[model samples]
Target: MLQAKAYFDTHHHVGVIDQRIFSGFLEHLGRAVYEGVYDPESPLSDEQGFRRDVLEALRAMRMPLVRYPGGNFVSCYDWTDGIGPREQRPVRVDYAWKSRETNQFGTDEFMAWCQETGIAPMMAVNLGTGTPKEASALLEYCNLPGGTYWADRRIQNGHEQPYDVRLWCLGNEMDGDWQAGHVPAEVYAQRAKAAAIIMKGLDASIETVACGSSGRGMSTYLHWDRTVLEYCWENIDYISAHRYSENRRGDSAWFLAEGVEIDRVVEDYAALLNYVRGVKRSQKRVYLSFDEWNVWYKNMEMDGKGESAPHLLEEVYNLEDALVCAQYLSSFIRHADVVKVACLAQIVNVIAPLLTKRDGLLVQSIYYPIVSFAQHARGLSLVPALECPTYKAGERGDVAALDAAMSYDEASGTVAAFLVNREQRQEMRVVLSLGDQRFCEVLSVEVLGGGDAKAANTWEEPKRVTPRSAEAHVNEAGELIVTVPAPGLAVVRARVSKR
Candidate 1:
């Protein structure tokens, strides 16, 4: 069933649009940082020893900013151990990844890799097993100009210059039991507040992300936000949120419902931010950094396997998962109004869109929508409200509908519409009407689909599930009716003439 809704407004200047929302993340969990992005022996390596193939992929996507060196791994990590000589560097157990942590690819390697990939670093501190003093030392090591002690030691380690990284995370996931030095909400709040203060005291130029509950479903979610903000309301520039959808329901309805839940997480955070701002009676707005997000379920059981065997976080993705990924990315752009920054969990090899091997990296089928959105959807994120058509997916709990977003770029004189259809076997002929103005023509249409909802891509056949163009056009009524395929994601670009 194809349904339609139309509305428009001009003055919705909601939030500061941070280009970092297009940013990706690189953690030391899987091959994401080590053999994934940097392998010295690879023939495709650049001068800095970063993989050229991976660099080219990132460059093509133009992922301008990224978070580095730890997800949960940041908790127990000692920044000092990995800074100096390669031989003297220690190899310890990575409780997070359950692998032997070789100090070979520490801060310096990451900074170099960031340079090669052309991404700014958003580093996270070790609040789990380390102290505020240790956090300050790392800031000095990375951002301070060449000087005595930390800066000089960075010089002695063969890198005479400072990295000058401007963004930092206070801690990884302080409220979660899985984190190494996990503490109570109040304890984490006090520690995160103190860390933000000192971290700011050390480098006022950098922006800090204070830890909120790891996700909305966490036991300490609400209290964690309130307590953390009580101490960090002023020092921190942004509050962080992390979430991943695990589809145990194994049906379209479950997937659909969980998808809405992810957006609800963002909605909840915005509300929390508003509440705190009112309580403090402060004018400063605390933005959100969704530094961790993606469709992850590959390593669920690996957690019980033990830390030394840190579950290899590699997730072999399929067609359904990729569609879910596209839907999530669309949600990010749609809500980019409040979400200043979002890191798509680990961007490569480890629970990611693009997979890498020794020979070269393969662009997953899911990578297209992300690339199109990231490159094209940079202009005004106009608030596009929709009366989404509903259906009873076996995830929506009887909520049947469509998920969509639109961006009108003034410079390009174009309107880009991203839409996803959740119901099985139903094509949506949505009348995309311009509520206030007129669009001359719908110039391009990119559609991603599958013969069956469960179809996917594999190593033997990479194109098993990919999007294809369909019958779509605009009518004289100035309404755009495009066929949105079942379980498909569509991007329509149009050029507007005049009133």
Candidate 2:
């Protein structure tokens, strides 16, 4: 049997534990904008053109914030095209997603949608085709006290009050060659610094994120982060990172261990944050924003048609992706101190865990782990010690035999354990030690299990991949043992009556 432990120590429970790590993204490319969030004619859409079913699903996740406007779309995006009137708005080509972007749902519409769905908006500006002046105007339009030109324009467009959005991204992946207007690291750092100064000048309360490398494997990953942070370290509050994964090789064992990749990236980025902090000689520590991440590249085909106007980045997730999501959630909670914000690449049909049809929506396999952690996992991250043996893939070398992250939520009086079992045909017995704490009850046990790797949920039979619960007990010394099946993700919560 392998042992893993999480302890509740008051000293370990630190400052404000933000649930914003449970945030999401909404880009203009796919059904994410058109059919997913903003279809006026859908049977399930509300009066505001927001999908009622999708809103309910997102409300259930209890999302704290959602990044808006673009993924790659924001790179060359012109925010002005979507603002004033629906009738006069341009039908522009979206080169990034290979679709036509109707400027109907711009800043005003998105803010309204966020208000209706009860999710805060974290806006990313259009540095790809925009200037510091243009970015400043947007900041004034959404956040300034309604008096300036942009502010008056927003008011004239039906918003009488300020949106007062406090979070901003200076640019989206300006250092990546794949981005629409990729800039050299030096040029990007300079522009990002200037933009941060202007955006903050518009609203001092706003926190800004400067661009880092697109992902861990970028040739300029470390250098770009270092160079950008060196220039904007004192100006911005966070540095952004984006990554999309797919089982290109489809090697189940190796693919299941992909969560380790997200972690290694985050942990290394955390180190970069520290390096910048030391160089600046400041105690005002800056954190990281993993603004975009998901199991994408599955639906993007090389020879596929440009399809049509909302070339929906639709991906039907599988059981394996769920296991990967669970392990990645563990990584987020494990490093909660540094990674203050994260968005699950998207919230709807565009490679998201929540899939939607015209009338109804279904939760994908990955949804279970993300929702479970967002609902129950909070508090200071505790170092979880695991004594599981190791596994190896064809050249990937010793991956974690078992993947998990443990944290104690003092307010809820529960110790949450999120774990993933990636081993094929092997049920590993995991002994969870609660570390000398008395429990009140077993609050919950949520697990996503399937008979095969390709298991998914469908509109006709949506509950095929939802989480199911089971009962477990702790002994007098505070230990609960269970066997984790292959390709399964589990979250166990034990309550304490004393707290």
Candidate 3:
């Protein structure tokens, strides 16, 4: 087996890992909101029309937060349209996805679903066709106590208590022309500034996320972000980032090196945030909300055809995609200080980890890594110094064959390390060097890997590419040893104490 070395000290930590970083997203687009999560007609659904099996799977993943109501769908969405009686609700044309929205599952339904599933809701307002006043009104409806117009409306609607959603997005991808109301950076920043000011004024405790550049591929990427931050610096708490990696070239090494690309994106955004803060000389810091991110190039075609809950962007993730997903989690942990919140875009049937049918749920290959990381990778993120061989990843330059991140929970004396081997055909044996704190015993070692890179899971064969138990131990020399399969990822957790 190939050999690698990694060194870590409990003292040299990155930051406290925010549990929200292991979050998921749900959009009104495709089947994500309809048959995916909310289905009144399914036998698997609860009384509120939420899919019981889907909620169970999500709970198993340990997702703490879920971004709701939109992706591009919210750009033109009217929250009020979905609020009142279902019989009176109007069915509008969803301009973003070219589908029809029945408004059957609206704000109250979503909040109820979130409450039952134990996930915090992160909402996005419509800035495309909506006004700042409208944005503030929605905030008031969700967060304010009674006696006001919107709050009283909420009361009349049967909810006396406020939803009190803390995290709000000004808009979704306002810089993209494909969006419902794509505008110039100056215009978006102006609108965002107004919205944030009023929204915060309404609640004063809510944290707002200003829209940054849609993606690095945009011509106005950094420029748009700079303008927005320079405008909404004090009002907003975090800048929203959206990223989706594609295996366009069919190069496994380059595809697996997506983590390096993710690192670059985070670093670039962090630098931009710092620059804006310096320019404003502001004491208040803005972190990143990587709200929409995942491997999404597989199913780009949207075949909505005016249908409700069409199978749009329903990507069947392969083993390589799962490895890429692991890399994403590892990178998020490595940059836990800067990237405080991340949502795996669209949690069900829309380029998601869990695919839902009327009868059953299909857990994708990417689901295992997410579950592993979310379950064990918690508490303080530890910085690991690694010595590993490198492979050329095209424009990404020389990329390490081994990618890794570590987290230690002081309260539980638990240390969990997530490792990925990018080599296509060789297993790598890694020796972990712990300084001062020696691992006492191995808790569990699980590997998500298979011989075929393109292996995926389907309803017919749900466990086709699932994770299996692996071997790892604390050696007599006070080191930890584990062998990770090629083109695979592993999560090794152990009990630890000071030497």
Across residues 1-499, which tens digit of lDDT does each residue of candidate 2 receive?
A: 3443434443444344568888999988767888888888889998888899888888988889999887778988888898997999988777777767778898899999998988999999977767888899999989876878999999899889899898899889888788887889888888888888988877889999888898877898889989998888889999988888778887887888887788888889888888888888988878888889888767873221344434456888888888877776777777787788989988887889777778777888888888888888777676666777678754577887688776777677777777787776666667676444566577777667746887888887778887888656776765666566666877888775442
Give the residue spans of candidate 3 off by over 4 A: none
lDDT of 1 at 485: 76
lDDT (10s digit) by residue, model 3, range 1-33: 779998999999988999889998889989999
User: Which of candidates 1 and 3 is the stronger one according to lDDT?
Assistant: 3
Shift in Å, residue 268, candidate 3? 0.6
What ordering of candidates by TM-score runs from best to worst?
Answer: 3, 2, 1
Candidate 1 residue-wise lDDT, 198-245, digit = tens: 878877888889887888778888688888887788888888888887
TM-scores for every predicted model: 0.93, 0.94, 0.98
Q: Is candidate 1 or candidate 2 better by lDDT?
A: 2
**Residue 346 of model 2, lDDT score:** 87
* Sliding window of 10 residues with minimal summed lDDT for model 3: 450-459
Q: lDDT (0-100) at residue 242 of candidate 2?
A: 83
lDDT minimum window of 10 residues, candidate 1: 302-311
